[model samples]
Target: MSGHSHWANIQHKKGAADNKRGKVFSKLARYIMIAAKNGGGDPAMNLPLRYAIEKARSVSMPKDNIERAVKKGCGENGGVTFDEIAYEGFGPGGSAIFVDILTDNRSRTNGEVRKIFEKGGGNMGGPGCTAHMFDRKGLLQVPALAVDEDALMELALEAGADDVERLGDLFEIRCDPTAFQAVRDALAKANLSTTMAEMTRLPKDPMDVDAEMGRKIIRLLEALDDHDDVQSVYTNAKVTEEMMGS
Candidate 1:
């Protein structure tokens, strides 16, 4: 969870800057649209949509934008139909990479992804090539000062969490996706604040890379994330503070 927390902190900082530039709005919209399409427009009845909207809000995506995306998915504005796809691959230093994409044009997305991988010194692998090394889990980050570790552990476990780990100044709680809301609710009831909560792919094992390789992998991930069609990019690369600072 140390590695997970480090990456989460980095992402939180990066996301703040990206939101100011509206760079993350597009991705948030796509996620909202897809969630609505899959689970209907009612967030109350759709947990996934609820989660998507929360994520969008976390990035400061405007309320108007969120509503519009929901409407688009509900066919109110005749939005383009998007298909969700996951691309798996190996990046520099044999890092396992997983890319989530939303697009109406499969051929275009494939070509663009391929080119980015090539340029980043990586190669796209067949579906399931890298996905097998990961598991879908609900992750929650709680600030260290918010609660005592022992008490937090008891609460999380009683609420059906799988594990809890201390990461620097945060508590990382892992739970089954189905139990995410329950655990979140329990924490909230206890007046605990969460820095972030989401159902994300967790790597079974991480690959450590030298500073140079770490930079290359991060660049590759950033480039993939920058693509309009890419929703999110997950990797098993263990990036150190020294590597990130460098």
Candidate 2:
């Protein structure tokens, strides 16, 4: 139902500018380990672990690496603990930004994140600042060329999805977080493949920006995402490749 597509940001993130594959893998492993530790390694019984594993596989994380992380988290190896934190802020164009973080030392990570925000022309805010601008939901992105629209709509809706609509070249299936598994399972069973699937936050009001503002917002978001402790970055701004000026 939304006109703004997150596909542009998704495309930007696929760039290898400064994101080394090893560092990306390490971050995903942390996610997997924490999920497996909190809940058992069984993805069926553990929704968080299922999401973590799905993210890992999306990045092509090795099977051996994923199994090792699960074992490590299950206490087969020494247990390491991490704290989950959410950082909120406003970008150059007043776009709301939300960052997910996983860190062992909150103080250090906080300082680092704040510095990144500042250097990128933004300021990190206290709790509940930017969070109110977004809604947590399940987003499954399927390429338009992949499946028939009516079929996807029927299958997704029957599986408890809230809505299904074409966003640019992709069909986005939206659902409540609780229904994500059911919807995902339904798609899997029907052999309908997705380009991307995840539990994510969608902006309540999509931010519109000029080319200059779009460049600044995208830079700030990319900087936040590249941090070692940062897990994910979400923004309300709709930035296209053309807006990322040099």
Candidate 3:
């Protein structure tokens, strides 16, 4: 697996822990609200909202909570409006970092994120500094046991996917941003369930970090992820199983 995929798998495992604490629900709701606000309340007409709803359902978020978030975004109920923001920076061992945020107060969110970076041995960089090193793409992961590799590859290629990679027990599918939903629908039609499907920033060149630096980078990432305004954190830092277990 690539460093990015490895870290993603680790986060997928940690998602269970986050759900137990109810943090995952909060984050998922925020995403749903934002998606609804941007693309309207109907999931059928709004691809992003449909994606957010699927993610929330996978985490077992209550239907009522999801409905409330969508209503709030549609202004059926008074709720704080969120603004999307992205922050780029460098972390321990010169690892490239990208943070996606949704917040009502940019000033406060910016200060808090900057403080987290400094406290965790990283320094925030100007916009586009680290972002230029990455490309945004639709990523989908299907369990290897779900279907035969050859069959899956043919299906994905026919669905307009760019590349498909075998990673241990999973197959990672990459696709153009505009074709993400179509590709996902095609996979579903093939009877293959996805483990994860999301738009993400993939780094062109990953930075390797020793165990010590890896641990520090993970800590920084966890802190950022825990913030209510922060949606996702992307980094190029590589971690070994030993480092993650530590």
TM-score of each: 0.95, 0.92, 0.95
Instruction: Report model 1's TM-score to 2 decimal places.
Output: 0.95
Superior candidate under lDDT, 2 versus 3: 3
Per-model RMSD to reference: 1.5, 2.1, 1.5
Ranking by TM-score: 1, 3, 2
Q: Is candidate 1 or 2 superior in TM-score?
A: 1
Estimate the overall C-alpha local distance difference test score of candidate 1. Answer: 0.86
Clashing pairs in 2: none
| Candidate 1 local lDDT, 1-246, one digit each (tens) | 446434445555667778877878988898999999998999999988999999888777889999999999888899649999999998898888999899989999999999999999999999999999877889998999999999999999999999999887888999999889999999999998888888888778867677899988888887888898987788888875566644
After aligning candidate 1 to the native by TM-score, how far in Å is the CA of 46 from where it should be? Answer: 0.9
Q: After best superposition, candidate 1 residue 8: deviation in angstroms?
A: 4.5
Cα lDDT listed for each candidate: 0.86, 0.82, 0.86
**What TM-score would you give candidate 2 relative to the actual structure?**
0.92
The sequence of per-residue lDDT tens digits that candidate 3 reaches over residues 36-122 is: 999899999998999899989988899999999999888878964899999989888888999999998999999999999999899
Model 2 regions more than 4 Å off: 3-20
**Angstrom error at residue 113, model 1:** 0.9
